[model samples]
Target: MALVHHDPQDGILITRIGQAEITVRPEPPASASGAPVILLRVDAPMLDTLAAAYLDPDEARRLAQALVHAAEAVRPATPWRSPRPNTR
Candidate 1:
């Protein structure tokens, strides 16, 4: 299985596949009412690619917020850790 790593500080998830790496991050919506978007960037020794997708705003917000929380959780004690993790 490929190893996956998360860097909450940068709001990114990375997966290593063979010799290539895939990175995922959230991108701001293009329109007020449009769905949230997730951007994907793939990099290999010889090539690179980029892609994105729009998803349900509610769901996206939940996910994005979760990631931000995760990023905070991994940090040393600080003010941002007061809030508990979401359970939904």
Candidate 2:
């Protein structure tokens, strides 16, 4: 990733996601101190298409693992092989 924007008043970025968003903040009344949780949401919305979910740190970790597991389940054991070149 590149430093697209930088400003002392804008604050530093903790991380970035592709077509998705994640924010960590304390729950409930912003004034009151509470356990910090995460808010996961999609970056873009097509025709009001967006998936938003409130998840704790633990749940976030599990979600990551689940994503990996699901991806691996359908992932090919070997990489795709291109067709052989024609000798003719």
Candidate 3:
């Protein structure tokens, strides 16, 4: 069986995966209240996006905030920095 999933609720988190991908799809129409479509895709194991969520903008924002807060709580003291672009 494949390892890891977009969210812990969806699959078991047994292995230590080094990579993941999160993508935000195009939003639904402003007035389309009933149209709750999948807005985010979380792909673990780095190869496929097998998990998704149909969250509205507000819900997405709240989830993002929670994730950031929890991440900060357990994050290493040394901040993670983006690599500088190579200049040739």
Candidate 4:
């Protein structure tokens, strides 16, 4: 299994399901947002594909574990930092 991000601006969302890899995402909008409200909207075809790929119990477990690990690894190590350093 692999991690996936649905970035419409970027393009396709690529990820691995069990041993197979797949790409799925919504079409990019014509307009852009000033304050990006990133939202992932997965459709039926993508859901069906994912469901079918993980039909096997063992495969599903493996995928779940992989997803957990992937999420953990991506977590920020520290809080955000300001561009200008604090001055006395």
> Which candidate gets the maximum lDDT versus the true structure?
1
Summarize candidate 3's per-residue lDDT along 26-87 as a digit string, tens digits: 44555755654436766686575468777866787798799887776678446874465899
Between 1 and 3, whose TM-score is larger? 3
For model 1, the local distance difference test gives 0.70
Q: Which stretches of candidate 1 lie over 4 Å from their true place?
A: 1-5, 8-11, 47-88
Q: Itemize residue pairs with steric clashes in candidate 2.
A: none
Computed on alpha carbons, the lDDT of every model, listed in order, comes to 0.70, 0.55, 0.60, 0.49
TM-score of 4: 0.29
Q: Candidate 4, residues 1-88: lDDT per residue as tens digits?
A: 5666556677547666655556543333435743222223323454454332212345445665888767656773457533556687
| TM-score for each predicted model, relative to the true structure | 0.38, 0.46, 0.44, 0.29
**Which candidate number has the best TM-score?**
2
What's the number of clashes in each of the models?
0, 0, 0, 0
lDDT of 2 by residue, 1-88 (tens): 3333344453323333554443333244334665656666544433446666777779978987998767766884458644658999
Model 1: pairs clashing at backbone N, Cα or C within 3 Å = none
